[model samples]
Target chain A: MTISEIVKDILSKAEIKNIFFVACGGSRAACWPAKFFLETEAKHMATTLFTSNEFVHATPVSCNDHSIVVACSLRGTPETVEALRVGRERGAYTVAFTGDPAFLGDPDYALARAGKYMVPYRNSDKLSCLEGNSVKLFQFAVELLHQAEGYSGYQDVQKGLTVLDDVIAAARQKAGPLAQKFVNAYERKDTIYVIGSGPSFGTAYAFSICSLMEISWIHSPTVHAGEYFHGPFETTGPDLPVLLLKNEGATRALDERADRFLAQYDGGHQVLDAQELCMDAIPEKVRGYFNGFVLGSVLSDYLNLLGKARRHDRSVRRYMWQVAY
Target chain B: MTISEIVKDILSKAEIKNIFFVACGGSRAACWPAKFFLETEAKHMATTLFTSNEFVHATPVSCNDHSIVVACSLRGTPETVEALRVGRERGAYTVAFTGDPAFLGDPDYALARAGKYMVPYRNSDKLSCLEGNSVKLFQFAVELLHQAEGYSGYQDVQKGLTVLDDVIAAARQKAGPLAQKFVNAYERKDTIYVIGSGPSFGTAYAFSICSLMEISWIHSPTVHAGEYFHGPFETTGPDLPVLLLKNEGATRALDERADRFLAQYDGGHQVLDAQELCMDAIPEKVRGYFNGFVLGSVLSDYLNLLGKARRHDRSVRRYMWQVAY
Candidate 1:
């Protein structure tokens, strides 16, 4: 059977009344759709399940013949493989998906999802779950929405994929509108802090590693911006470089003036405004998030690069986040 | 002058051209109205901005004399206060509002928008921002909008707030329906994870601390349900309890399934099927967030209480966040 057909089979299967779909970061994104699919499919049950890292350790009980661990990973993260291993150990059925079966072995449902390298570090492994293999993991589950208990509406599981893709594409275009400015603001600064809220918070978490700490090896810290005002502000000074997620979600007056009000001795500041309206304006549902984030990412990328370009900046933690532990 | 009038004073005097507001976790919920306010106030030249903890520290560079730091904190967290302090030291005028002034002075613009309390910890402080502060922040900014640059239209701003408040209030009622279930879920789990996205993320962040972690002392973890599927899934098990924020702006599929699929584990689960339609169901605007979070928080409180009552389980984390330094 094709990927969708297999997903449909899993959707129709009469097992695991309460199912939890797990995955790695890649699967994490796909879990979005997987969630819709499972919930929509199993709406009739008391509840359908989905979780990632936190759940594996917490482990919610209640299992039956249907209880199984269906995990996904584009690269087959150790977490996914381990989850499947645990599922089998627990007498639950397990299905693992990956670009290569080598990660889990032949019996594991390692879907041939990987593609050629899109760039140097990035691989264009386009998994065909939906728009992107990432989307597919969830979309495939969404396609099973018809099976979820009490689920009434036949939600066009693919309703907004195209739009989302467009949005993401558009956002990616403007990825870092204020990268240089952030560096310029804190010319002599030694540390960088990235603040975000909601969905952007996750982006902020990854951004710090990729944008500055990873590339330039700068000591950057990510926080839930609201927490900064709680008490962390005392140490902030010209030495701290502040970058605000200018996404159009929850940040407004806080992001704008929060930095401006900092004491003159406070670190430098900038706003990476990836306004969501522009993100919401994507034509096709598929590009939605890509467009929304692309532009802001560009700006973010620039800030990290700008610091490296300056060369004279010696305070950069050459091995930021490079923990020996 | 009223807070609105004072905002106008600052905008005109500061010659503020662009403004961005920075908030954290739950308080970041203000981003919605703050954005509306800045755009309205500037007429054209100045736009609004919002960022979470991660972004504020990494990539914000755009600024002008008009720049100000408007920090929000109910608890006066160290990082946030320090961030604000950093802003002030950087020569940016700082305005802060908190439930407790132990670390801060009284609010001249608004006298402690809300009061301090321990039962709810700093959760009530976040409520203060949600109820009227966020809207007022927007309205105050709107009053400044006229000929600042080249923008006009308090119409959009007002409408947004009106709709936002009403929707938020209505959604707040979920606390009533889910309160008992929340408590019940908490009773059984060893660890609790609050999963959310978009505006709901802040709300979820608050629940993790106040409900499960702070008050109840449950081992609660807050995660972007979508992102949790990545690496965090390693933490899951049959006893983990989870709360899924069923708001529209989340990474849809993933969040919806979080509660139910999580239920399968028998660890524990609560589904806060909060819809935007329920936002206006709130009795008082000020009490909106407080009321909204009640059911879920109460559940967390109940769970924490139950665990302690049994002396069988311990709370999630000793501290909300590790100092990490």
Candidate 2:
């Protein structure tokens, strides 16, 4: 079934009073946009995003038959599978986004097929994480909002989805040269503070841990732009390498505030404002929602360049999947 | 009014459908236990924790007359005051936990008196953050649970609270020597990864950003223990400095897993297990709930010793209140 059809059918049968977005790492970060969208748009419906194991260990008291649990894993993460199982046990309408059945049949994915509704998203040699994971999960949210509330932004979301690929391409092209410049100047720097706010903070978080740390072996820590002044801003210095992202969201002012602070205190900092991306193709009404897509794509460009300059393969890992973690 | 009396009065007049815990920095971290408690025990009411600015910028759609907004700050953070004002404008019942009225009357706190209900919490020369902030916030939660749901664990919570002070003192004594050893060995290291899960994660977060970074000028980033294996564990190595906290909550296994990995791969990591703390005075049933209090007190010892060793006064700051963004 199409995402719309699946959501419509589920809405017809169950009164989903709450949503639990469960995953880990990048997938957990990806859950942010959907949770933010629902929190902002969906009245009377509560939503939460949780790390998979935390979800399983301390399952929300509200996770009942009336809850919808969306669990994501690129290749059947064990905790995600268990989290889905826990959701199912609680009689929640459970959805899983994972690799193909053939991949799930591997020993590593022994219990991956736990979702009541399995939505297979491919992960191959190439990196299509944004397209495969975040976009698909967001489609679920869009479909849910449409079917449940006759959300007026449905058309805007559809238009955004249609032009999103082109927007991502444009962003990648625009960011490529800038990323190369960044790599040339700051190639030896070990620590970078990646900052953003609202929905864009998800991308900043993903880039810091998944890309900079895991992929490029750089010590990058994420700080929410709104949260920067609270405590993390104290660590800022003249030589601090800060990568700040700005998006045209309601919380854009927070990101701009952090950017302004970094501009004053930090010399080795870069600002990747979503305004620089060619998002004219996306509808103006919903451009804010698609900023994550643009930011994720552009940050991927930066990470790829940094990885290449440091002679590190993005796929290379010393502990992940190789060791019995 | 006392916390119990205040919660009782609030409950008497209105039916609160949801709770929003709004704050920034350490105050925001203090909201976790209350939010966690509601998520775990409250069957119908929903709860969310938000950074104050984000709460103001993208207010939740559910913030209606039936919503309870609990805003926290030591001396009225500007964003927090704005957040409470937004909550009040939305017709939600607004509560504030700020400093005494005299301190709040200063020019810096011009807009601090935004909440419909103001609860004074003190911040004197000594460090009483856990007591003045987290403990008070948690009292509101405990009273809320007892009043709203007639929670059977009320007596356990009461017993736990009665012994919490002693538990904290015992934890401090036990942790002081270990912290001195830790400071002697790893004081020069600039980066430390602080890890925890469940409610205890709040303490880890507070210690990392508020104590380590803001107070001691050390580079510390927080990682949830459940989130460690997903991507962050890849960044762990032999020479890395890791400060891991373990609690008796349902998510303790996650912390133990991260602790095991650190033990094997890193020799410099220090583990502060709640089980080691003298929590025997607290009720056995609610011991897990007070682990955060014990952990916070013990971690404060570590941070204090480290601050002394580095010759960095905990009060020293380059940008906090000295500069404007």
Best by TM-score: 2
lDDT string for model 1 (A133-248, tens) is 44544444444444443234333224455455455445545553344556566545544667655335545655554444434444444555555443334335454566767545
Tens digits of per-residue lDDT for model 1 on B197-275? 5334555765664444444544444566655433344334465455676654223455655555566543555566644
Error of 2 at B186 (Å): 1.7
What's the TM-score of every candidate structure? 0.41, 0.95
Which candidate leads the pack in lDDT? 2
Candidate 1, residue B3: how far the Cα is off, in Å: 4.1
- Pick by DockQ: which candidate is best? 2
Give the lDDT of residue A12 in candidate 2.
86
- Those runs of model 2 whose alpha carbons end farther than 4 Å from true positions after fitting are A101-112, A123-131, B102-112, B123-131
Q: TM-score for the second chain in candidate 1?
A: 0.58
